[model samples]
Target: MLALPAESVSEADVIAGILALMRERTGYDFSSYRAQTIRRRIRNRMISVGIHTLTDYLVHLKSVETEALELLDRLTVKVSHFYRNAHTFDMLREEVLPGLYRRFGGPLRIWSVGCARGEEPYTLALLLEAAGIPGTVLATDIDEAALRAARRGIYLRDALRELPESLIGTGLEPVPGDERHVRVRPALRRRVHFQVHDVTGTALPLGTTDFHMISYRNVLIYLQREVQERTLLQMRAVLRDGGCLCLGEAEWPPPSVACSLSPLPQRSRLFEAIAAEPIA
Candidate 1:
């Protein structure tokens, strides 16, 4: 068997070292993440810390306590906003929710996996409330910091600028006297539950839920092919029959899974899930 080239072997070693340290300390296993993305993130961290070599960076990572974890969180790309993608929400409002209502009864259960800072799940809650759909939004992410922010349910006023007029209802209102900060309504916030969850793992605190819909969105793009497959399988296991799975416009599922992808008219990023008949 041929050995990997010297540079390739060295990069792999760095990634392996980082994965080992992260798993041991933070329980975030980036072992199955794509190498290029991981390497880029690590390199960016190194530059930010003024470290020249991977070895030196690893040493710094070891010596630092909470800061190392913060670095990792930053690299995870947690940037998100309410109604980040407008078309997708539009489709959910016009087509998907109605389909779910016709198929299932009231009180829909939605899991927004990797819901960073509560934006996506909160957006869903707002839309559902506007549509008069009785439902609960379970928002989850691996990062505790992000989860904390999500739980606060407070966001910058500008983050909501893109929300459709229908979803926003009246114009944005201040949180009493605070002009720069805005809080989602209590009624909307009441419908959401935020928790820390690592999608790559088997033990999701959420039980075997009959989820009517799931929105993983851009989260899977950070993972490697194998990790994506494993996560998708776990998601499929929890999803109810005939329920839908929504992904980011840039993300695509493996072709082996038998399900129909129906494109919504107004939404480019949204696709509806149709169950394939069992082949006996």
Candidate 2:
């Protein structure tokens, strides 16, 4: 087993080493995530593995191949609920989506980046269905396991708490003999495709200038400022002219990308791509 210096290495050094090793070994980069989020995840993983010291954790991470993947999962923890902010979905359903469909014309395409366990994409599918629009959703996440669970299309009752009542019977069906759980109806699930994608990587899913809408809510808050700016730029490049970009209520396009995006009137976190304007 390779070793990091136990006596002299500070927690920050050991954490940086762990992150670097993870990038080298697993091909996933967590180095661009905020330091505090990284530290908290590392500490959580240490507790899980019964390693109290950061130096020891680094040594253990180097020796165990599975530990790297485990730690990656910890660092990219995916926690979300269906219709996470009820008001956001309400706005999408009542205002944003219909306009996009009308403007873009048939077969509306939506991308749900960092879609976590699939709630966001499935929620979109439900909205499309309710609006009687012909559309498909592409859901992507860096975590393969999360995508696997998403493909399964199942959720517990609590996860559906914020799900609008009208959608409950239409979008989800109860699992056999499992009252506490429900699965996205097969018909609705058919409208969403899940893939493993890392936002930090160079490639953009589907290609540039493609999607009519991109819902990247809540994921940016954890990334570094540089990464956040890069991601917002990517969103700008891929979104069609006048396409909508939905962010978490607390999030906004960084100044660098703000010129390419204009906030919609009365919408909390919704922005429209100014695709034709020079982003100066």
Candidate 3:
């Protein structure tokens, strides 16, 4: 019988060691994620792989490169649907977008950060088409698999449950020879561009400065404080003056950047970027 190393090393230390190994090998850092979330995800991954002990899992993780990838994928939460939060989209369509459309003189440039499986960006695309606004959406996520699916523009029928009735037949069509799935219309797909991006990193895409709106919903709740602050600042830097920043209903900007964002009236999680002060 293999003696359990957890008998000597503390559970927290063992978990930390596993996270450090994941960071070293994958170049994706989960070290700063909420401790409980990280631990739970690690526990789930261990169970999936049939590992029974923390120390044992750490040893196995160190040996298997593929396990590292699996762990990384497990860390990303990809829960999204078309018009996931109806009220938020309702506010966007009714009040927010018209103002932006007027400000930009026609076409708008929007970015959907952490665009899981492409639902959110495609939703934005549908909104633009419905409103007769000529706009482009840049949908980015750190998960390559999610980006691939987003690019494919196909989804199962259940994914459209929250989608408004008016949008039916406008953006998505039933997949032929298959009753269970649908695909975004080609014109709608053309309006949104998908890319793989790491929000925790420093770089923003080229021409990011002119982005009129950025929807960064539901993603920040998983990050550590410092990372959340840094990521908010990055989004702030890329947002054009008076552009909108849409967050998940439960999320708020860290205190450090709160002063630079003003929430829209009667809107649950929408904020407008305050113009930066000029350096003397």
Clashes (N, CA, C under 3 Å) per candidate:
0, 0, 0
Candidate 3 Cα misplacement greater than 4 A, ranges: 1-6, 276-280
Q: Measured by C-alpha RMSD in angstroms, how accurate is candidate 2? A: 3.0
Among the numbered candidates, top TM-score falls to: 2
For model 2, residues 112-227, the per-residue Cα lDDT tens digits are: 99999998999999999888999999999999889999999899899988998898887899999999899999878889998888887778875435889999988898999999
True-vs-predicted CA distance for residue 247, candidate 1, Å = 0.1
User: Each candidate's TM vs. the true structure?
Assistant: 0.89, 0.93, 0.92
Give the whole-model CA lDDT for all candidates, comma-separated.
Answer: 0.77, 0.87, 0.87
Error of 1 at 101 (Å): 1.6
Model 1 TM? 0.89
Tens digits of per-residue lDDT, candidate 3, 93-204, equal 8888888999876689999999999999999999998888999999999888888999998999999898889886899998889999999999898999888888888888
* Residue clash pairs of candidate 1: none
TM-score of 3: 0.92
Error of 3 at 127 (Å): 0.4
